[model samples]
Structure formats: C-alpha cells, structure tokens
Target: MIELAQDSGIWTATINRPEKANALTDKMLTELAEIAEEAGQPGGARLLILTGAGKVFSAGADLDAMQGGLATSPVWERLSSAIAALPCLSIAALNGTVAGGAMGMALACDFRVAVAGADVFYPVMKRGFLPQPSDPARLAALIGPARSRLILLVGQRLDAATALDWGLYDRIAQPGALMDAVRDLAADVLAATPQHVAAIKRLIP
Candidate 1:
C-alpha cells in the first residue's frame, strides 16, 4: 500500500494503491504512523515528502476495509496524531485527486505543493462523515476557518490555482512534476540549519 525511497537526508513516502484511488486502509494508516515515527528520529531524515502513485492521490478511507464497521476504530485518531507529531519537516506533493481522510494526511504536512489542475478537496461531509478534530483545526490554521469550511463542509473540490490563492498550498507545479517540485522545495528548505528551522517554526507559529 506504500513505497519508501530514501536518499541522504530526504525520504519519500508514496501511497501505492492506485486501483482504489490510493484509498488508505487501516493497515495503510498504521504503516504510515510507523513511517512517520521512524522518519521523525534525529539524523534519520531532514525532510520527508508524502505523495501518491497513479492518477488519484488518495480517495480517503478505504470503504472495503471499513465495510465491517472498522470506521469507528481508534486507529484513525492514533494515525492522525502520529502524523501531526512527526518531528521532521514534512511536505505533501499532491499529484492528483485527494479527498476524505487523505486530505487529512496532506494537511498534516508542514508544506503542501500540488500539481496544477489536480483535484484537491475534502469531501467528508458529502460522504456523511466528519474529519477527525486534528484535520479541521490544522486546515483552519493553514488556510483560515472560512476557507476551511468551504472545502471541508461545503465539499468544494479545489483546483490547484484555487488552493494556491487561498494559501491552502504553497505552490502549484505542472502536472507530472510534483516530485521534482517537491525535491526543489526540499533543497531550499534543507539549505537552512535544523536549529533555525525548528526555532523559526516554533517562534512564528
């Protein structure tokens, strides 16, 4: 359900279940938590990029896996918190359509750079679902409550341009260049000292 590729201080995690719009299963979320924990260790990584393979980034919770009523399991809260607590710099390269819990994953990152024309939104309300607490809070902090509601509650599918305009994403690259763009952004971020990065991140917000 995922792939990990590392180079020097940069690590990339890719959601691999493209056949299901990369929908995350309970197992997948568990694996993601593990990855986040592993990557958070000092010297293990300076930057971590979260991405998805194939056409759709991730459609959110895998209905198939939740069919037996695993939807209410505590695993979701654990996974969300793990992603939020990860210590290293995290970036989300939204290369395709992103929705539902998958949107929460993207929001967990410190920076989000998506591909232009990509469909990026959280449609939890449309599915009769609610985002975990961390999701809405983080989204509101990143893009403000008004825009957050527009996306989360209203089920607005935001294209890259709209996302950038609302500050939902830091930048919008051409489709198919998401990773390259992320790599460049990572390089820029890595140019700074870790102490400085952490200090600024903490002091400013």
Candidate 2:
C-alpha cells in the first residue's frame, strides 16, 4: 500500500507494507504511478519524497505475486517513468534496505538520501531475470560501469557508505535522523525558485 500526504510545497509518499518488507504489489505500483501523475500537475507540490514505512525501504516485487505471474517489468517501468517525468524535484529517502526493482525507483528520483547503515542490492541476475534495459545505464550514470557490473552482474550488496561513495546516494544520514536529513535537503531545495528548480529538472538528462 502507499500513503501520500501534502504540506506546503512538499508531497511525501510512503510504502506502507512493512510486514512484507514493503514489497510492492500491482495495486501499490499503480498507486505510485497515480501519485506521480498527481505530483506532475499544475499547482502540484514542488517537491515529492518517496520512502518506506517501518524498516526496509522495499524488497521489490512480492514473491507470491511474481509466482502468480502478476509482477511484470512493464508496470514497474511505468511507475519509474512516471516519477522521472515529474516536473518537480523528487527524492528517495531510503529509511532502510533498498533492493531489486526498488533500486530502479530510487534511480528515477532526482536525488537520494539514505540512512547511513541501509543496504542496497539487485538480485535479478541471481533470480535468472534481467532488469529493464534502462536500469543498467542509470546505474552506470550514477556510479560507473565497473560498479554497475558489481551490482548487476556480481550481485554485490552495497552498504550505504559504499553506495554513497559510489555516488548512488546524494547524502547519508545517521540512524534516527534520516527524515531530518531529508527535510534539510528539501529545505535547501525550497530556497530556490520553484520555476528555476523545475526548469533545471527539465534540463537534466
């Protein structure tokens, strides 16, 4: 499930299924896409934050749903694309672990702020599956081809510090300070004119 709230110029969306490590279902992914669409509208929030409730950020697709053939890459792509297309700046606040397809969602965001001890990994290769074509390029763009290979091919689970060093995280926050750090970054972003911020977002690749 997804929880959305708006205050002033900021909108926050939290993945709420902590029992399953916040693994996304089809309906949840649909809700995320819908939220992204809403955030893109005129007079919408100037900043959007994506995060997870409880501990883990997301465990990617629900295994049961995948077993039922309900988890498809296209739907995931649609969700990621919707976030990427938003006119406002978007940030991924990684409260905990970020895994598998959820990595793509974070990569789609304009910035990522992570808890210092959170872990990140993609196990698609181990599962005998391939990610969407753009995912590798996005990873490479953030880090580099060598690190991307370590993640995508070697199945490396990167700690937050290493990921930050590799450029996957824009900032790292100490435990219990993740949201505060995110708010600090958001405040800095808010200091800029919304028009200019949106224009810069549009100008970025």
Candidate 3:
C-alpha cells in the first residue's frame, strides 16, 4: 500500500505494508509510478521523499506479483524514470534493507540516505532476472561498475557503512532521526523556488 502526505512543499510517499516487509504488488508498483508521475507535473511538490514503514524499505516485488509478470513489467522503469525526471529534488529515505527491484527506485533518486542498520542489495542475478533498464547505469554512476557488479553479479549485501563508503547512500542516520535527516537534506530545496530547484537538477544530467 502507498500513503502520500504533503506539507508545505514537501511530499512524502510511504510504503505502508510493513507486515510484509513492504513487498510490492503490481498495483502498488503502478500506484507508485503514478505518484511519481504526478510529482513531475506543474505545481507539484518541490521535494518528494520515498520511505517505508516498519523495518524494511521494501522487499522488492511481491512473489505472487512477480510470478504474474511484475518482474518484467514496464512499471518499474516508468516509476524510476518519473522520479528521475522530476523538476524537484527526490530522496530515498531508506528505513531499512532495500532488496531486489526496490533498489531501482532508490537508485533513481537524486539522493539516498539510510538508517544505521539499513542494507542494500539487488538480487537480479540470483532471481534469474534482469534489472530495470536504467537501473544498472544509475547504480554504476553512484558506486562504480566494479562495486555494482559485486551486488548485481555476486549478490553481496552491502550494509549501511559499506554502502555509504561505496557511495550507495550519501548519509547514515540513526533510526529515530531518519525523518530529521531527510528534512535536513530537503531543507534547501524546499526553501528554493520550484524553478530554481528544477534548474539545478537539470544542470546535473
């Protein structure tokens, strides 16, 4: 499930299925894509924060959904692209481990910050599937090709420290401070005009 909240210029999207580690069903994924698309529209929020409830950011595609063709669905690509193309700043405030396809959206964000115990891994190889098309280049851009291969090819799970060291996460916050950390990261963008934020982001890539 997805829960969206708006305050001032900040928009937060929380994956609310904590009992299931926030595993994404096709409907959930599609909803997320729609939300991202909405954020990119005129007069949308200037800061979009992607996070989750409970202890995991997301366990990736729900098993049944994956079997139902969720793994190969274009929704994944669409969601990430929408986020990446936003005129505002996007941050993945990782609450916990991000596994499998969930890594795609997180990587697509302009910034990623995680709690101390968070972990990052994409099990594409182990699952006998390929990642979303833009995901690999995004991953490599953040952490480099060799480290990207270790996760995508060797299935290594990088803990918060290692992920930060390797450039997957930009900052590590303690559990209770996750939102505080996100607000801190978003402060500047939230204060800036939408045109200013979009101008800076466009200059990046």
Candidate 4:
C-alpha cells in the first residue's frame, strides 16, 4: 500500500510498490483517503510530503484496476480530489519518470520538487484518448497552456531540468539529497503560521 512516517510536524507518505513503479490501486487510493482523513484531524498531522519508495514516484493507476472499473470508475477522481483538498500543505518529491494519470497526483500538490533523473510524459493522446477532461485548467495553472499542449498533444517527455526551467518544479535537488531537501522544506512550512500559509495559498488566484 503506502508507508506513513512522521517527523516533528511533517508527515511523509511514500508510495511503496517499487516493483510496479508504485502503481496506484483502488485499495491504495482508498487507503490514501483514510490517511488524509487521519492527517486532517486535530492533533494529527500538518504538512504532508509525498514521494516514492524505490525509483519512480508512480506509474499511474493499476491497469487491472482500470479495466475492472470499466465505464463507471470514479476512484481516480475521488482520491485525487481528496489529496488536493487536504488541509495540510502538500509537496511532491518526484524521484523518477512519471506518466499518464500519475501526473494528476503530482499536480495536486502545492509544491513539487524533483531530482535530475526525474521526467514526465503523458501519452493519453497517442493511445487514442484525451486526458480526464478536468485536467486542462490545473495543467494550465502549473505549466501554462503552451507547455501543457506540448505535453498532452505532442506527448513530449520533459526532463527534470527542462521542467524546472519551464516552472514545473519549484526547485531541484540531487537524487540523494531530495528527501533531505524535502524535509527542510517541510520544516520551513511548519515554521510558518497556518493562517498565513492558508491565506497566501488562497490568495493565489
């Protein structure tokens, strides 16, 4: 499923199935909802930092799960929205390649940090389909329309440095230093007043 670890006020959620590139499962998504619920409560958790176990962050939803859903799957959207709406500030620490619906999870975070080896490619179009339909607005906000078009339409793979240059990642760290960097970032966030963080984040229209 997932690994939950805590430091002072920071909670780190690690996607643990490295064998499958930490692919998302319906059970995993449901577990995430429960984790979010726990973290949202009083005296529970504050800032949440998400990363993966071995190499890649996540390779997107489980193909078996997706097939099982058929035409009526709401699991993906539900879990993504839950992750997006958590009161705790969220940070994504990408370790490797990201693709397909997995980008949706990364996009939900308030801040994203990646290592040089990390990259992302969304190939829904090449597969003869479009994105989830609601992703355009968020994608535009993070990386702008032109880049988003390049990614979604052309299916270009963006290296970490290129992504940073294009404003995809707020910062980049060496692969080995990523977690340390993320910890420092979480500490900085935890040091701030929750009201200020909430206010400033909300004011970003």
RMSD of candidate 4 to the true fold?
2.0
* lDDT (Cα, 0-100) at 110 in candidate 1: 83
- Model 2, 107-194: lDDT tens digits are 9998899987679999988977788656898899999999999999999999999999899999999778987888888786788877
Per-prediction TM-score to the true structure, in the order listed: 0.91, 0.95, 0.98, 0.89
Clashing pairs in 2: none
Q: What's the TM for model 1?
A: 0.91
The CA lDDT of each predicted structure is: 0.79, 0.88, 0.92, 0.77
Candidate 2 whole-model C-alpha lDDT, 0 to 1: 0.88
What is the C-alpha lDDT profile of model 3 across 1-205, one tens digit per residue? 8999998868899999999999999888889899999988998878899999999999999998999899999999999999999899999999999999999899989999999988888899999999899999999998899998999999999999999999999999876999999889888888889999888888896
The deviation in Å at residue 13 for candidate 4 is 1.0
Q: What's the CA error at residue 50 for candidate 3, in Å? A: 0.5
lDDT for position 144 in model 4: 93
**113: Cα error in model 4, Å:** 0.7
Write one digit per residue (lDDT tens) for candidate 1, span 1-205.
Answer: 8898898778888999988889888888888878888887666667888888987778888887767554565666776676666656789888787777777778878888887756787777776766776788888998899988888788888887888888888988875677788878877668887666666656555
**Residue 85 of model 3: what lDDT?**
90
Runs in model 1 lying further than 4 Å from the true structure:
none
Please say which candidate is ahead in lDDT: 3 or 4. Answer: 3
| Model 4 residue 32 CA deviation in Å | 1.8
